[model samples]
Target chain A: MKKLILLSLIILSVFCSCSIKTPEEYYKEKEKGKYTATISINCETAVKYKNSKRKKSEILNNYKVSYNKGDTVFTALKNACKANKIQFEYTGAGDSVYIEGIDYLYEFDCGKHSGWEYSVNGVFPSVGCNAYKLKNGDVIKWLYTCDLGKDIGAVK
Target chain B: MFKNFNPIALFIYFVYVLFISVFSFNPIILTAGILGAVFYCLFTLEKKSVFKLFGFCAFMFLIITLTNPLFSHNGRTVLFFINDNRVTFEALVYGAVLGLAVIEVLIWFKCFSTIFDSERIIFLFGKISPKTALVLSMTLRFIPNFVSNFKSINTTQRLIGSDSRIKRYLNSFSAVITQSLENSVITSDSMKSRGYGLKGRTFYSRFRFSTRDIVFIIISTVLFALSIIGRTDFVFYPSIDAPSLSGFSIIGCFSFSALSLIPFIYELKEGIRWKYSISKI
Candidate 1:
């Protein structure tokens, strides 16, 4: 009984440690079935900087993805990037994961105020991407803004 | 050579080198600073101490360079995945640059400590704030004194046949702490008796602003200005930005290298002059 209790505790801790599941694992488990979403990554505002390393404005246009009920915009974006083989990088984890860069363009690359920002259904959520949960048929757009969302028309 | 220069000149030289080492991330600038510092250390410090310093710096550099990729996962050109996190070439480069910057700054500081001894420190700050200068000098002097004091205490304990290792160390540490506290009180009392912070106090110093010092100061200031004006911007995240060798950046690197080597150059000139004078005699 003591051995069984220790094993259960270890299993519980393992689950707790990895509470933030990858999209593939979430799809495999399908705890609340699945819902479809679309995500696009663009560096439209980077055009203002002539010397920027932006390959193209449209990185991934209207890319479709699937996620579970509790999945966030970040999860959908991650799934889309993985499927399309597009490079993605972020810092922190869970609800605090900041999308640092996509396609080699990082924060402060173009200018001081330049960085990656995300919007859901045409509304820019002030919170981090991982913190903003996604609904079914949601449209997620990851934009590289050179002016802190002002030039991207994301400010409201 | 260092002693002949005015305290202000030596102070300015050290400050400029430290500022450049700490602020600039350009590869050329960093490499130049490291080479200059290592060369200066070779000239000034004993071989054994230099080797020890280099060995410790290398260990620290490797630890920082390796551990950075494990934590920072933001970069292109993924090498592999450790626990599903991408370790990239850019992060590795960034970490190595960071490690070099830290080591370079530390070496420059070591050089500073060798030249800017307690007497020079007192001379520099004594006029403006005598109390602060006294405290700073005393604090700086206390560290090595504490080490020697502990060693003597430990030896005395050993002579009296205290054989347990843990007990010996613990006893010596406690004794050192108490002794330091007592010494601080005595030192303060002595200073008070001497009227140390009294106004209208006159200080005697051998340093003077000579023609050679004026020339040295001008050269260092010009080099420092050139380095600041021509410093290159570098990016090492998401993707490693290749260090551009633009004309301005090359100028910056050259001037910075020259600035860092001033001390070594001075020492060499002095050594050559001494040899020539001996031969002539």
Candidate 2:
């Protein structure tokens, strides 16, 4: 009986030592905020492939994005596309973003006329195209050819 | 009687062992846990098999340590250099630590498997249709049989000149799947023919909860609670910035490890009693 009591005490002590704080409590301690936005993608270079000679029409519609504090730029872009109801495909090697079957070839290109710039922690890169870490309020833009001109929507 | 060899206690201890091994940073705690597992296996398992397992774990540990530095490059302290590449002291230590953790986890899992043998499966989940239970039991039983069967199938395939790497892989995979499906069908037929779940099925277990079980359960539960509480607010990292010895911390870590050994001690006591009774007879 005495042995049993001692063993019970040990078990209780170990259990109490390892208890984890709830996720809500952790976030409250960290003080994070959430953001939502829309990301648009247009494919301009797609040619007629199947039983048609006319140029393929490109569209970038229905992008929805949401992210919390400390989310990376890639994650933010993904969340934004999901929130805006836009269909997008990721090129697996982390180069180029595609929307509605239209590939945005210039987003990853660093040459002049690429019309894309990347910044990390408010500092622009000197050379080479690399992933830029994102901060709050940082904006990412992609310019693609569209026949219908630009469309804009707000995210809450 | 095997005093205090309760399945519930063994399950709780197994969980606690895994928890401590993953969380505890102190090398002493980790080493003690590894040694305790080895000792427990020695006390319970056949000697030759346990020795073979120990040798395999040692070989695996060496291979992991040698290969881990190729991928993970973290840690500040560089111990040596191979050409332009640096072999950090941290990588070797980390690999050994991970290897030990894996072996310890496997040992704890083995204990759980032994404690909750087929009989306990029937007792706890007997209400689950006999068809389902029988399928699960057969699946568990078929793993070893499948491995041996695959080896024989591969040898025959090699003899038949169908031994290209791709062909071997495809043939072996298809063979195992076909055999497993056949085994499952046979098991189901046998179970149904025996009227497995006609009306209700009865189960027999060699386990019962005595006073010892109650005491063991209470103690293990309490220890689990305490370990969780101790870990929650405590910041061990960043403080572990260096590998300096602190005697008090060492003692504290070992004490926790020793706490995990309660079930093993209980089993040892049971073994001793059984031996004594047999001798007297």
Which one wins on lDDT? 1
lDDT for each candidate structure = 0.83, 0.55
Q: Write the per-residue lDDT of candidate 1 for residues B1-281, one digit (tens) a residue.
A: 75569989888888898898889887678989999889889987899989998998999899889989877877866776554456788889888998999899888878877777778888999899988988888888898899999999999999999989899999999999999999999988998898877898878887778998899889999999999988986887767776678888788989999999888887888889999999999
Give lDDT tens digits, candidate 2, residues B187-264.
778877877777755666677877877776677667666555443222221122444445645445545666667656
lDDT of 2 by residue, A73-98 (tens): 55655554333323223333342332
Q: Which 10 consecutive residues of model 2 chain A have the lowest summed lDDT?
A: A147-156
- Chain B only: TM-score of model 1: 0.96
Ignoring the other chain, what TM-score does chain B have in each prediction? Answer: 0.96, 0.74
Q: In order, what DockQ does each candidate have?
A: 0.16, 0.02
Fnat for the candidates in order:
0.12, 0.00
Over 4 Å off, model 1: A1-35, A45-55, A68-70, A107-117, A122-128, A131-136, A144-155, B158-167, B277-281
Native-vs-model 2 lDDT? Answer: 0.55
